[model samples]
Target chain A: MTQVIISPAKANSMYWLGRYTERVYLELHLLRICFDFMIDGKPEEYNRYLASIGNTFLYPDLAAIRSGLVHDKNNPVSVLACVEMANDNAILLRDEIMSPTLGYIQMSLEYLRHAAAESKEPDLDELQKLTDWMLAFWGSIEERVYDERVKNFLRLGKLIEHLDMNIRFSYKFYRIEEAFTSLLKCYDFEPRAFSGDALEDLKKLITEQEYDPRDPVYVNKVLLLLGKVVIL
Target chain B: MQSLIKNRDSVNRWMERYGVRFGVYKNGVFNEQLFPFDSIPRIIEKEDWKVLEKGLIQRVKALNAFLWDIYHDKHIIADGVVPEEFVYASKGYMPECEKVDPTGKVYSHISGIDLVEGKDGRWFILEDNLRIPSGASYPMIAREITRKVSPITFVENHVADNRDYATILKEMMDDMNGGRGINVILTPGRYNSAFFEHSYLAEKTGAVLAFPGDMTVEDDIVWYTGLFNEKIRVGAIYRRISDEYLDPLAFESSSLLGVPNLFQAYKKGTVAVINGFGNGVADDKGIYYFVPKMIRYYLDEEPILHNAPTYLPYFKEDYDYILENISRLVIKDVSEAGGYGVVFGRDLSLEKLSELKELIIHQPRRWIAQEVIDFKDLEILESNEKVERKADLRAFVVSSGKDVKVWKSGLTRFSRNPDSFVVNSSQGGGFKDTWIMD
Candidate 1:
């Protein structure tokens, strides 16, 4: 088989497509959990979710919070916005990724727009479909994309985003460790893209015995280290 | 066929799921809209296709010969078969490519010849698009989805398979490459009007889809730039960009969408540019008037295809005739394309007709008047109702180093409006697959 060569722009687009799709998927999952908590009489759950994602703006009510997080076009962290960004990047990689693979992103964008237009409050079922489409999108990517290097770049973006989101949500140490391990496997495909010193520092921080999820300074340090791992 | 028509909705939905769309700019904002597919196919009988196939191959071969002569020996001009003024004064005539020769002397490797069938069972050539002709992918993908939606329709009808277009394209590119390096389809980015076709064709042909800055030239050789500064030599490029925006250092200095010195690589014979440079001169509307003469001069044979009755105002007799019969003719400005700069004399008021007459008299070489043939209309599905609409067929011809071959199927575009004859995608028209009977 002939070697598949990817240009810089295509590689960048593929990486970002992976990252943004993961962002949309994980954000909706977290939002659904927080929404359940709010429904169970914990009104402060929305504020806690916002703080976890590092978003500063607060919604006026539960309805406002759901709309802002799911359908707000102006909100950079909104599910709709992330879907659009993933689509924008996927559009540029259609030749490499194939149309059927790109179709999932297009479907998700169309579904989000249609659902938002139909209701003021975010429909949980429709949001569930968006998450399903993201899963299908990744599935299509795995089945359709042929180049191993292209898959590696996209997988790297996905693993890194998963690690970042798990760290932000203060997940269990095992989950963070699993995400980082998955990322390290993909990072081995293109180690030149990662900073060696930062990789070493992140390895040390994650392997530490007292790696507490509730410690703010330690979490900040891990996040900082994670940010420095990828050198664009 | 009935089953296909009944499942038009499913076919269109499949088209949407695959993101089959074309980009258009309205009021300075770019929007990507789905190229609506009508399930009702335009069926061509095998006997009719046989004649069309012969005519198209003959025409493309003659056109290639004309380009070679015009750029090198100028024998057609020397013999006065084609007017010197029409050849030299054409906007597509480039002095920079006067002596440059492309691989295998194949200038128009791919030709999209637009034709409209008349009510009298005659096909009249409307235009020849030798430079970056689109709409092939629309029909190619439409057939894919339509067959999926209604396999029984394909089974019942003995229609020729239209799926070999990508293979034909690949073979042509390989013929031009001559085992140099990898093949790439260079696109002007995703915002271009035909970006979907660009990407789709790249995927189908197994060619790399390259954007503007994805390539660079060094020492008269073109190379694709990888993320880590790795360079892979490009053997052939099926460039979708216009000649003006192909190379910044050679043609348009201000073009950011062109690779600098890429033209130098082409001129040095280090790279093969499909549908080679300086091909616009042959496809100009004014130059279209002499294509029949070109067939005779170059091929030593009578044209199997017929040109629409066209009169160039550059000649005294034709000029007087156009002025005398202004209301019955359609005047076209040779410089504009995509259904623009076309004026029906019947639609213009008396004042506008007078102004057009003056413009034609002052700049006779810039215009051509054709007797509008009442082309046969094809039936299209509109809101669950079958309606008659004006449609034209765009047959694609591929010229490799070996021979010229015409694809069995064509892109049949129809005007959605009842009163309109323009069938371009940019003008909000829809498309139907052309099924050539086996």
Candidate 2:
């Protein structure tokens, strides 16, 4: 393998590209579940969904929720904004991540723009295609990116985002533990970006006998510790 | 060829899928628009391509020789082959580059020479873009898509493969670097007009795509700043930024897009800067009138290519002739490029014509007049209908050490407007792929 030199700015971009792409993918998945619940006449499920992502905006109805979560450019956590952010970073890292890998993000952004222009209800089928593209994007990265360092940085971001989202949604302890284990493996690739003390503290907190995954205080503690683990 | 044309929409959709775009700024706002690709290629037969290849190689060699001469011994100026006034007065001539030698003594590692075929079946040299010429990537990527969309087009046509452009480019960069360190393509940033080409070439050539501040020079050694603050040496830089905005401390002190001591590192022979500095003196519009003479003076041979019938206003006889034929010639301001500062005398009103003539007369050294060549119009597909449009070819020449090679395929850019002759992408023109028959 050729010696790959990743500058600080490019490292930051790669990390965020991984984070935002994963954010968009997981958000779409969560939105589908919430939309299915709303279809069953559980309209307040939208408020619970917003609270899980730490969004304070109280969307009035399903239409408002759909518009706010998917099309609103002003909302930083909106699907459109996250996709755009992923694209901006991908543009910066074009040479690191080949064009075929970046093309998936570009296609997703183009689709969302067209959907937003029509101002119709979010199409679930189209969103499924987007999720598939996101999966393809990661698959391309794994196949096309030869530099191990580049892949490691990107995977670190992906693992970090997965753990964050899993904690936010209060997933099972075993699933969160599995994500943490995968994140640690990525951290082993570039341990300098991680804090040793923070990693130990987080591990201790997660594995403690009294630890409860559903407790808000325990979840907040894990979230704070997860944020501190990656200094970069 | 018919199959390729039939699949034009599929080719374009693939282009969009690959994010093929160029950025343009209008009214201080930046916009990235897809570079429109016409399916119909400008085909060059084997016999014609042989002559063109030889001519381009000869022309670029002479130009490189001229750059070396003007910057060093200046024998051309001393022997009265090229005037001293034309050399020193050019905006491209940098006094700071008097004795700085590039690695391998190759000034123009990459040269984009523009040419137009006249109606009489003769090709005329339009311009020599030795300073950071682009558009090679447009056709390079287009060929990738065209081949994928219409496989039969390749099976039927004996077209030369242009995919080796990246290989040749990588070879040139490696030759220049001489194994001193890794090679890098220095770009201003993502907002620049040719950012796509910059990143694309970097990906293709396996060179690090570096932006401003990604590199720093300390003690005349250029280094790429790693993520953990470790410094890696950089040997050769195929810089895409213009000369004036290259090094802040050397040229433009207020330029935030340049490394502070990069020029120092280059001058110290620690780094090889591709298309070496002070090349503007050779490609200047006024200096273009002397390229044929340069060919004879430097190469001791007759010119292989013909420059357009150009008149330099700095000369007394050509000045008088230009004044008499003001309405028929095209006046060009030597300082401006990218289809700017070009005026056809016939397009000007009587008042505008008088004002232009006054400007030319006052700044005689800053203007050149050329008799517009009646170039052949190429047929392009527009709205599913065929129409003839003015087109020109930009052939890329890569010089690695003492060897020079011209890429077989060139960028065939055509004006979208029926009456316009400018084919620059900045002026809203589209491009087509140039196919060189094997």
The models' CA-based lDDT, in order, is 0.90, 0.89
iRMS of candidate 1, Å: 1.9
Candidate 1 regions off by >4 Å? A1-3, A54-59, A208-210
Tens digit of per-residue lDDT, candidate 1, span A50-125: 8887665577877887888888767888888898999899998877888888889988887777767775688787
Determine the iRMS, in angstroms, of model 2. 1.6
Candidate 2 per-residue lDDT over residues A132-222, each given as its tens digit: 9999999999889888988888887888888888878877778878888888887788898898999998888876374576788988888
Model 1 gets an lDDT of 0.90
Using all chains and alpha carbons, the TM-scores for the candidates as numbered come to: 0.97, 0.97
In model 2 chain B, the worst 10-residue window by lDDT is: B99-108
- The alpha-carbon deviation from the true structure for residue A118 of candidate 2, after best TM-score superposition, in angstroms, is 3.0
Candidate 1 chain A, poorest ten consecutive residues by summed lDDT: A1-10
| lDDT at residue A143 of model 1 (Cα atoms) | 87
